[model samples]
Target: MSAQRPPLPPFTEETARQKVQLAEDAWNTRDPQRVALAYTEDSEWRNRDVFLRGRDEIVAFLTDKWRRELGYRLRKELWAWTGDRIAVRFEYEYHDTAGRWFRAYGNENWEFDANGLMRKRYASINDLAITADERRVAR
Candidate 1:
Protein backbone atom coordinates (compact mmCIF):
# COMPACT_ATOMS: atom_id res chain seq x y z
CA MET A 1 0.00 0.00 0.00
CA SER A 2 1.13 3.56 -0.65
CA ALA A 3 2.19 5.67 2.29
CA GLN A 4 -0.32 8.31 1.30
CA ARG A 5 -3.29 5.96 1.13
CA PRO A 6 -6.59 7.79 1.10
CA PRO A 7 -9.64 6.81 3.09
CA LEU A 8 -11.42 4.00 1.23
CA PRO A 9 -15.18 3.69 0.60
CA PRO A 10 -14.41 6.70 -1.49
CA PHE A 11 -17.08 9.37 -1.34
CA THR A 12 -16.06 11.19 -4.50
CA GLU A 13 -15.43 10.23 -8.08
CA GLU A 14 -11.85 11.43 -7.90
CA THR A 15 -11.20 9.18 -4.93
CA ALA A 16 -12.72 6.15 -6.65
CA ARG A 17 -10.65 6.89 -9.71
CA GLN A 18 -7.57 6.99 -7.57
CA LYS A 19 -8.39 3.63 -6.03
CA VAL A 20 -8.92 2.03 -9.43
CA GLN A 21 -5.72 3.63 -10.68
CA LEU A 22 -3.77 2.15 -7.81
CA ALA A 23 -5.16 -1.31 -8.48
CA GLU A 24 -4.33 -1.09 -12.18
CA ASP A 25 -0.86 0.15 -11.39
CA ALA A 26 -0.19 -2.90 -9.28
CA TRP A 27 -1.73 -5.18 -11.88
CA ASN A 28 0.47 -3.87 -14.68
CA THR A 29 3.53 -4.47 -12.59
CA ARG A 30 2.90 -8.19 -13.35
CA ASP A 31 3.45 -9.30 -9.81
CA PRO A 32 0.56 -11.65 -9.11
CA GLN A 33 1.09 -11.78 -5.37
CA ARG A 34 1.01 -8.03 -5.08
CA VAL A 35 -2.14 -7.77 -7.16
CA ALA A 36 -3.86 -10.48 -5.13
CA LEU A 37 -3.40 -8.40 -2.01
CA ALA A 38 -5.87 -5.87 -3.32
CA TYR A 39 -8.67 -8.37 -2.84
CA THR A 40 -10.25 -9.89 0.23
CA GLU A 41 -9.01 -13.24 1.51
CA ASP A 42 -12.05 -15.06 0.18
CA SER A 43 -12.53 -13.20 -3.06
CA GLU A 44 -14.07 -15.12 -5.94
CA TRP A 45 -13.17 -14.51 -9.55
CA ARG A 46 -14.43 -15.82 -12.86
CA ASN A 47 -12.06 -15.03 -15.68
CA ARG A 48 -13.41 -16.24 -18.96
CA ASP A 49 -14.60 -19.81 -18.36
CA VAL A 50 -12.43 -20.34 -15.32
CA PHE A 51 -13.69 -19.93 -11.80
CA LEU A 52 -11.33 -19.13 -8.94
CA ARG A 53 -11.99 -18.56 -5.29
CA GLY A 54 -9.88 -17.12 -2.48
CA ARG A 55 -6.61 -15.26 -2.54
CA ASP A 56 -4.58 -18.39 -3.21
CA GLU A 57 -6.57 -19.25 -6.31
CA ILE A 58 -6.45 -15.66 -7.49
CA VAL A 59 -2.67 -15.59 -7.26
CA ALA A 60 -2.32 -18.92 -9.04
CA PHE A 61 -4.66 -17.87 -11.83
CA LEU A 62 -2.79 -14.63 -12.39
CA THR A 63 0.54 -16.42 -12.46
CA ASP A 64 -0.73 -18.86 -15.05
CA LYS A 65 -2.20 -16.03 -17.13
CA TRP A 66 0.96 -13.92 -17.12
CA ARG A 67 3.08 -16.91 -17.99
CA ARG A 68 1.15 -17.49 -21.22
CA GLU A 69 0.43 -13.87 -22.08
CA LEU A 70 3.87 -12.39 -22.43
CA GLY A 71 4.46 -8.64 -22.58
CA TYR A 72 0.84 -7.92 -21.78
CA ARG A 73 -0.47 -4.40 -21.46
CA LEU A 74 -3.89 -3.47 -20.14
CA ARG A 75 -6.15 -0.43 -19.92
CA LYS A 76 -9.25 -0.28 -17.76
CA GLU A 77 -12.18 2.10 -17.94
CA LEU A 78 -14.86 2.51 -15.33
CA TRP A 79 -18.28 1.71 -16.79
CA ALA A 80 -20.80 1.81 -13.95
CA TRP A 81 -21.09 1.53 -10.20
CA THR A 82 -23.40 1.65 -7.24
CA GLY A 83 -22.04 1.44 -3.70
CA ASP A 84 -19.53 -1.42 -3.55
CA ARG A 85 -20.21 -2.87 -6.98
CA ILE A 86 -18.40 -1.55 -10.01
CA ALA A 87 -18.15 -2.47 -13.66
CA VAL A 88 -15.07 -1.98 -15.81
CA ARG A 89 -14.40 -2.27 -19.48
CA PHE A 90 -10.84 -3.22 -20.37
CA GLU A 91 -8.52 -3.99 -23.25
CA TYR A 92 -5.35 -6.01 -23.15
CA GLU A 93 -2.78 -6.97 -25.73
CA TYR A 94 -0.24 -9.72 -25.50
CA HIS A 95 1.86 -12.14 -27.49
CA ASP A 96 1.97 -15.89 -27.07
CA THR A 97 5.02 -18.17 -27.09
CA ALA A 98 4.47 -18.99 -30.74
CA GLY A 99 4.82 -15.27 -31.56
CA ARG A 100 1.16 -14.58 -32.15
CA TRP A 101 -0.32 -11.26 -31.08
CA PHE A 102 -3.77 -10.74 -29.64
CA ARG A 103 -5.85 -7.88 -28.38
CA ALA A 104 -8.64 -8.88 -26.00
CA TYR A 105 -11.66 -6.91 -24.88
CA GLY A 106 -13.21 -7.66 -21.54
CA ASN A 107 -15.72 -6.50 -19.00
CA GLU A 108 -15.29 -7.05 -15.28
CA ASN A 109 -17.91 -6.91 -12.60
CA TRP A 110 -16.46 -6.36 -9.14
CA GLU A 111 -17.73 -5.96 -5.64
CA PHE A 112 -15.52 -4.43 -3.01
CA ASP A 113 -15.46 -4.33 0.72
CA ALA A 114 -15.99 -1.11 2.60
CA ASN A 115 -12.23 -0.72 2.72
CA GLY A 116 -12.04 -1.28 -1.04
CA LEU A 117 -10.72 -4.82 -1.02
CA MET A 118 -12.37 -6.67 -3.87
CA ARG A 119 -14.68 -9.43 -2.66
CA LYS A 120 -16.03 -10.85 -5.88
CA ARG A 121 -15.20 -10.55 -9.54
CA TYR A 122 -16.45 -11.83 -12.87
CA ALA A 123 -14.82 -11.22 -16.22
CA SER A 124 -15.95 -11.94 -19.76
CA ILE A 125 -13.28 -11.74 -22.44
CA ASN A 126 -12.66 -12.63 -26.05
CA ASP A 127 -9.87 -11.98 -28.48
CA LEU A 128 -10.44 -8.94 -30.65
CA ALA A 129 -7.53 -8.62 -33.10
CA ILE A 130 -4.02 -9.59 -33.99
CA THR A 131 -1.74 -7.49 -36.11
CA ALA A 132 1.88 -7.23 -37.14
CA ASP A 133 2.43 -3.99 -35.26
CA GLU A 134 1.25 -5.47 -31.99
CA ARG A 135 3.85 -8.23 -32.19
CA ARG A 136 6.63 -5.67 -32.41
CA VAL A 137 5.87 -4.54 -28.88
CA ALA A 138 6.66 -8.00 -27.49
CA ARG A 139 10.23 -7.55 -28.61
Candidate 2:
Protein backbone atom coordinates (compact mmCIF):
# COMPACT_ATOMS: atom_id res chain seq x y z
CA MET A 1 0.00 0.00 0.00
CA SER A 2 1.14 3.56 -0.69
CA ALA A 3 1.76 5.99 2.12
CA GLN A 4 -1.21 8.13 2.99
CA ARG A 5 -1.00 11.86 3.54
CA PRO A 6 -4.25 12.54 5.32
CA PRO A 7 -7.34 14.74 4.90
CA LEU A 8 -8.15 12.17 2.25
CA PRO A 9 -11.22 12.00 -0.12
CA PRO A 10 -14.78 13.37 0.17
CA PHE A 11 -13.36 16.47 1.76
CA THR A 12 -15.16 18.72 4.19
CA GLU A 13 -14.45 22.43 4.14
CA GLU A 14 -12.17 22.26 7.12
CA THR A 15 -10.22 19.30 5.79
CA ALA A 16 -9.87 20.93 2.40
CA ARG A 17 -8.53 24.06 4.04
CA GLN A 18 -6.13 21.97 6.07
CA LYS A 19 -4.86 20.23 2.96
CA VAL A 20 -4.22 23.54 1.22
CA GLN A 21 -2.33 24.84 4.23
CA LEU A 22 -0.23 21.71 4.35
CA ALA A 23 0.74 22.12 0.72
CA GLU A 24 1.60 25.78 1.30
CA ASP A 25 3.81 24.92 4.23
CA ALA A 26 5.63 22.24 2.32
CA TRP A 27 6.26 24.51 -0.66
CA ASN A 28 7.59 27.28 1.55
CA THR A 29 10.23 24.91 2.86
CA ARG A 30 11.71 24.79 -0.64
CA ASP A 31 12.57 21.13 -0.33
CA PRO A 32 11.95 19.43 -3.63
CA GLN A 33 12.06 15.93 -2.16
CA ARG A 34 9.61 16.77 0.58
CA VAL A 35 7.18 18.46 -1.73
CA ALA A 36 7.34 15.64 -4.26
CA LEU A 37 6.39 13.16 -1.57
CA ALA A 38 2.90 14.60 -1.50
CA TYR A 39 2.26 13.29 -4.96
CA THR A 40 1.94 9.74 -6.20
CA GLU A 41 4.83 7.90 -7.80
CA ASP A 42 3.08 8.15 -11.15
CA SER A 43 1.67 11.61 -10.76
CA GLU A 44 1.10 13.85 -13.75
CA TRP A 45 1.66 17.57 -13.61
CA ARG A 46 1.27 20.53 -15.90
CA ASN A 47 3.17 23.40 -14.39
CA ARG A 48 2.90 26.55 -16.42
CA ASP A 49 4.06 25.32 -19.85
CA VAL A 50 5.98 22.25 -18.75
CA PHE A 51 4.46 18.83 -18.62
CA LEU A 52 5.87 16.16 -16.32
CA ARG A 53 5.25 12.58 -15.34
CA GLY A 54 6.36 10.66 -12.25
CA ARG A 55 8.33 11.73 -9.22
CA ASP A 56 11.68 11.84 -10.99
CA GLU A 57 10.47 14.48 -13.40
CA ILE A 58 8.75 16.36 -10.59
CA VAL A 59 11.94 16.48 -8.56
CA ALA A 60 14.03 17.59 -11.50
CA PHE A 61 11.59 20.33 -12.40
CA LEU A 62 11.40 21.67 -8.86
CA THR A 63 15.15 21.50 -8.39
CA ASP A 64 15.69 23.73 -11.39
CA LYS A 65 12.81 25.95 -10.34
CA TRP A 66 14.11 26.67 -6.86
CA ARG A 67 17.59 27.21 -8.20
CA ARG A 68 16.40 30.03 -10.47
CA GLU A 69 13.62 31.28 -8.23
CA LEU A 70 15.54 32.23 -5.12
CA GLY A 71 13.95 33.22 -1.82
CA TYR A 72 10.77 31.46 -2.76
CA ARG A 73 7.75 31.82 -0.53
CA LEU A 74 4.30 30.54 -1.36
CA ARG A 75 0.75 30.88 -0.16
CA LYS A 76 -2.13 28.66 -1.18
CA GLU A 77 -5.84 29.00 -0.48
CA LEU A 78 -8.55 26.44 -0.92
CA TRP A 79 -10.94 27.68 -3.60
CA ALA A 80 -13.26 24.71 -3.93
CA TRP A 81 -13.46 20.95 -3.40
CA THR A 82 -15.67 17.97 -4.10
CA GLY A 83 -15.08 14.23 -3.94
CA ASP A 84 -11.36 13.57 -4.42
CA ARG A 85 -10.51 16.81 -6.11
CA ILE A 86 -9.73 20.36 -4.94
CA ALA A 87 -9.07 23.69 -6.57
CA VAL A 88 -6.67 26.24 -5.14
CA ARG A 89 -5.63 29.81 -5.78
CA PHE A 90 -2.09 30.69 -4.88
CA GLU A 91 0.53 33.43 -4.97
CA TYR A 92 4.24 33.26 -4.51
CA GLU A 93 7.15 35.66 -4.56
CA TYR A 94 10.70 35.06 -5.51
CA HIS A 95 13.82 36.90 -6.59
CA ASP A 96 16.16 35.81 -9.34
CA THR A 97 19.92 35.55 -8.94
CA ALA A 98 20.17 38.95 -10.59
CA GLY A 99 17.87 40.38 -7.88
CA ARG A 100 14.80 40.96 -10.00
CA TRP A 101 11.73 40.09 -7.98
CA PHE A 102 8.53 38.61 -9.33
CA ARG A 103 5.21 37.66 -7.92
CA ALA A 104 3.40 34.68 -9.46
CA TYR A 105 -0.31 34.14 -9.22
CA GLY A 106 -1.91 30.87 -10.20
CA ASN A 107 -4.72 28.43 -9.82
CA GLU A 108 -4.20 24.68 -9.36
CA ASN A 109 -6.60 21.84 -9.68
CA TRP A 110 -5.62 18.69 -7.80
CA GLU A 111 -6.95 15.15 -7.84
CA PHE A 112 -6.03 12.63 -5.21
CA ASP A 113 -6.02 8.89 -5.06
CA ALA A 114 -7.50 6.74 -2.29
CA ASN A 115 -4.29 7.04 -0.32
CA GLY A 116 -4.40 10.84 -0.49
CA LEU A 117 -1.43 11.31 -2.73
CA MET A 118 -2.03 13.78 -5.53
CA ARG A 119 -2.30 11.97 -8.85
CA LYS A 120 -2.89 14.97 -11.07
CA ARG A 121 -1.99 18.62 -10.73
CA TYR A 122 -2.76 21.25 -13.35
CA ALA A 123 -1.50 24.75 -12.69
CA SER A 124 -2.04 27.92 -14.69
CA ILE A 125 0.33 30.66 -13.61
CA ASN A 126 1.31 34.18 -14.56
CA ASP A 127 4.21 36.17 -13.23
CA LEU A 128 4.60 39.92 -12.83
CA ALA A 129 7.84 41.76 -12.24
CA ILE A 130 7.62 43.77 -9.05
CA THR A 131 9.78 46.13 -7.09
CA ALA A 132 10.85 44.91 -3.67
CA ASP A 133 8.60 47.54 -2.10
CA GLU A 134 5.62 46.21 -4.03
CA ARG A 135 5.83 42.82 -2.38
CA ARG A 136 2.98 41.88 -0.06
CA VAL A 137 4.15 38.43 1.05
CA ALA A 138 6.68 38.77 3.82
CA ARG A 139 9.35 36.09 3.72
Indicate which candidate wins on lDDT. 2
Per-residue lDDT of candidate 1, residues 1-84 (tens digit): 422234366435666666667866787889999998888888888999999889999999999999998888877777776676
C-alpha lDDT score of every prediction, in listed order: 0.78, 0.95
Supply candidate 2's per-residue lDDT for 34: 99
Error of 2 at 90 (Å): 0.5
Clashes of each: 0, 0
lDDT of 2 by residue, 1-139 (tens): 8999998988989989989999999999999999999999999999989999999999999999999999999989899999999999999999999999999999999999989899999999999999999998868
TM-score of each: 0.87, 0.99
Task: Please state the error at residue 124 of candidate 2 in Å.
Answer: 0.1
